[model samples]
Target: MIPSDDRQPPQKGLFELYLEDMINLRHPLVRMAERIDWPQCEQQFGPYWCPDNGRPGHPIRLHVGLQMFKHMQGLSDRELLDQWVENPYWQYFCGESTFQHEPPMDESTMGRFRRRIGEEGARALLRMTVELGEGTGTVAPGSFRVAVADTTVMHKAIAHPSEARLMARAHRRLVARAKAEGVTFRQTYERSLDGLLMRIGRYAHARQFRRMHKRLRKLHGYLGRVCGDVIRQKPYGQRSQALDDSLYQALYLLRQYADPKHRPKLYSLHEPEVACIAKGKARTPYEFGSKVSVITTAKEGFVLDCQALRGNPYDGHTLHEGLMRVHRHCGHLPVHTLVDRGYRGSEITPLSNVRITGKQKGKGTAHPEHQHRRNSVEPIIGHLKHEGLLDRCHLRGHDGDRIHAVLCAVGFNLRKILRRLARLFGLRFIQELLGLLRESGTQTGQSMNQVVSIPV
Candidate 1:
């Protein structure tokens, strides 16, 4: 039966669907949507699907575009759809007419679309955004004279796993779901779960050292057996591919399990190859996201290059790649590039035209301003984390993580454009005022010089 919330009138107009009374010009996300080339974005992201043969009316392109805008503004899908229904301006931006009516698009459809398009499509969207910025002169050309770079970790969305707990959970959940769906399982999962959970709880909470060790050993043994059964059956493939990936990763982690004192390698059931990255900060000592490197134009603060670094590589090692990306994006190499102390090294010191701080790579003296300039990227990273939604990611795997990071960067650039446009009038006013002050000062100085000459 449909819930009370599901009941709605059949004869509602498109405008009647939305709750928002109006779309304000001052809304940053709305303004950003205007600057985008909708035609180009559509052409780039438009997938193959016929109108009748497709899911229904309201093309997938329109749905995807609306969803992207919503995410860029950090709105939920339901909220976005509601806003579209009520506000006419939002309807116009989303490619809807005044009288159209059909709930914007199902939330599940958006997820399926993201999965269908994969990370590559998302990256293309980000690239298009960057290209648009370049076309608009928002991204200044060759301004890498002093580029700032930093790294942060975005933690995965899962609890810390244990050898016993992982195996038990996977086994129980898989068996239960399969049984409910009327599938057969060779092993008894309930017994395994109870035994494993009891032992693990002991290991986790036991105060006595001897009891803890015994409980942990038993837990390991039980979980090891469960892992063998699951691997043998390969239940992951039968259920969901995403779940399959997660189970495979959990199995790998179980195999690598050791003392709690040992550091856990970056392992997510969803994205096994995710790297373990560490950026030395007082507040956040460790981060789980890929080592993403971004270089921006010093003058305009436009992103020149953004790439998800493979492995937790050294800061200096990424300089060449970062520069290459910048060159590719801007179509020219920067005359001068500035980096932080972490990038300083003997190998890089002798490089001509590149300005890096800290101990010169080969013993040449470091630049005094390098540290201060390197500090500039700190705020950019903070902005991406807090405002651009890079702080946490909901997608699975490295590719998903990479695409998410790039999108956040795109959002950041769009926001920068919005603020720049807003401040342009104020900045022009300040410039004019400064010019008048300078002219008046010059006239007064000339009068003083003439009076001195007459006295002489």
Candidate 2:
């Protein structure tokens, strides 16, 4: 259901005026809110909802505004809501007729709203930003024809995945869940596991590899004992899905312990889908998370498309899908898809009429001006990571990863548009000030002439 709009001026209460009256209308956020096409937003996210089911949710503008606010400032749900209550501009931007003294919704409700919209809805939000950029003249229409592309790792919010830590977490999680499922065990090892894990860490830090492996083996044996106990009690066919999954994880851990080198390793017991990607960096040779590919306009570096590539695919493998997304967003394929040497040996070198740059030397000579633009994407990716939410993802699962990456892109565009608006606002203000000074000067000159004529 669509949220009702109450932004009409006539409905204002006698005691409380509208937020538009209280806050500066010239502020960028207020100007931006006016620019956004709320009807189009209702059209985009309207299909997800049934017109007659449940009470109408909050206004689509509020949800989209909150999404922009979240990424623009790199804030979590709690932080955004806490400030939303106090910031009249934020309230006004979200279509609040009057100031909000209390939070509009709980933190958990925002999470549910995000999930309800899902990945496609998130992409719609990104599309809206692109439209806003084009409408405001912040991003040029010609720049969309040529885009620079790059990939970066969006690290998950998890600790370092050491053997001892993985084993201990698996052990504790399995035992606690089993007890909840009414399974009794001998020597649960909940208390003793922490001390053993601490010791393993200390030994490893002291360069005692042999002792660390020894304790690792001991922890592995204890986990094996728990697995044996559970197996003896509950048959595989009769176990709950979660119990079965835990049992398999335990078995996988045992297999890794038996053979120190294993394939398709599980980095975190809580987040099993995470992968170890080695991007050939000295400081961060290996990052354990998903790979995100971002495509931006060559002219102004506005994010045209962003995708989270799972399975840690080769950088070359992700180009086709990313460009296709770009086409979907911009309504046409980029003529030049510029990338680094990482995408040198890609199979789809010639993406239709689009000339893939960065592999050939003569290509740079052909387009000298845009050759340097490829490297500009690095700062865009850096900004998305450091300034937005892509540095460390807190959302769960691959869906969360996709949505988060797209929202960060939207936030980056909003930041650019805000700066452009602020620049225009400042220039206008200066022009007004100069006009006032000139008018006052003319009046003073005319008055002085009259006084001089009288004295003569």
Candidate 3:
């Protein structure tokens, strides 16, 4: 069943005061809640729930608001839930009228919510933020016409892959599954594998390449024998489908890791979709994740769009698709897009109505201001990684990658909106204060001159 907010006033009890009565209305979160079109979001998200079914789920506002807070503050689901309990402001932001001591929902429910929404829904959330920026005047109308585009890697949460580690992990997974299925293996190699892994690490650290290679072969042999045993006992029923899938992946990795000529290697066993992206950085030469294309307004720095590219495609080739996404989401193509030298060879479709600008020097050069805006995307990408959750994604699969990138942009834009609102409120407060002082001076029957200045 679709969840709806409780509209009734809080029941009279020992303490009649409610959270809505206590929180300051001028707070940024409180004010932002009012500005956001919750009814529209509820209408859009309500269909995900069955009209008549299991226990009612949490309110759409609670789930959506919690997601906004999670990315804006860079808090994990567990951490966000804990903080929501102690902060009335957070409860109010989630459309709660009364404060509750316990968590509104379980932490695992967040993952389900993300899966239910999928990539398209995440994009809608981001689009809503862009619309919010336009409505609040933080992002000027038609600013989307002049935008900047760039690409960055959103790294996944996986350890650095090595021959020893891969073999050991495969061996452990196979053994654990065999034990769980009540299938007795010829030899588990449990004790010997542990000591072998220790020696393999020591050998690699000491630059004993030959010794490390020899031990890796032994580990691979152990994994091969265990795999054979599991396969021989195969006739797995429906219940063992997950175990069968695990064995299939282990065998696939065994083949790929053993061959040096494999075109695409597996970097992570759990996150098979993770790709190794190499952006020529001096400090970090290689990044393991998906490449993301980010588009932002040239002047206001509001994020226009964020899309995760599947393979590690060239930066130049991603432009056409990025521009198309911008058009699909915003309903208009940019008039001009500023990009770096990496996008030099790419050709934009004429139908896009977007003019791509790269670095230019002497004659036929772009205007100085337009050229300068190309570098503006650098800091925005940095904030997306540091402040947003783009640095390390915690969700699962390729869809998770796309959803994570979009949510990070959503978070970034929300933070910017909040900062703008706070600045506006501060200026209004100062003006009111000055007006009050002027009124007092007039009432005192004496001319009082005063200069009140406030830093932006």
Evaluation by TM-score, superior candidate among 1 and 2: 2
Instruction: Report lDDT (CA) for all predictions.
Output: 0.60, 0.85, 0.84
Q: Candidate 1: which pairs clash?
A: 18-85, 18-86, 154-289, 246-269, 345-361, 346-361, 346-362
Please list the residue runs of candidate 3 whose C-alpha ends up more than 4 Å from where it truly belongs after superposition: 10-14, 179-184, 233-240, 351-359, 363-368, 446-456
| Span of 10 residues, lowest total lDDT, candidate 3 | 447-456
Clashing pairs in 2: none
> TM-score for all predictions?
0.69, 0.93, 0.91
Model 1 misplaced regions, further than 4 Å:
1-34, 47-64, 86-88, 99-102, 131-139, 142-145, 173-210, 227-254, 258-266, 282-284, 344-354, 360-371, 425-456
Candidate 3 lDDT tens digits, 196-265:
9899999989999999889888888888888888887865563287678778777877798689888688
Tens digits of per-residue lDDT, candidate 2, 379-417, equal 898899889999999999989999999999999999999
| Cα RMSD (angstroms) for every candidate in the order listed | 9.7, 2.3, 5.2
Highest TM-score model number: 2
lDDT of 1 at 326: 55
Best by lDDT: 2
**Residue range 1-456, candidate 1, lDDT tens digits:** 110111224455654533233455445445556677766655654543342453344454465566566655766667777766665665655654333456666877666666766656666666666676765556654454556555566655555534555655655554554455445445554665576567557756766657655665665565456556555655444655544544555455555655444544534444556665657778767666677787776666676555666678887787777676655555566655666657655135332245555445544444533434655676777777787667777767766676676767766776676676557645767899999999999999999999989953
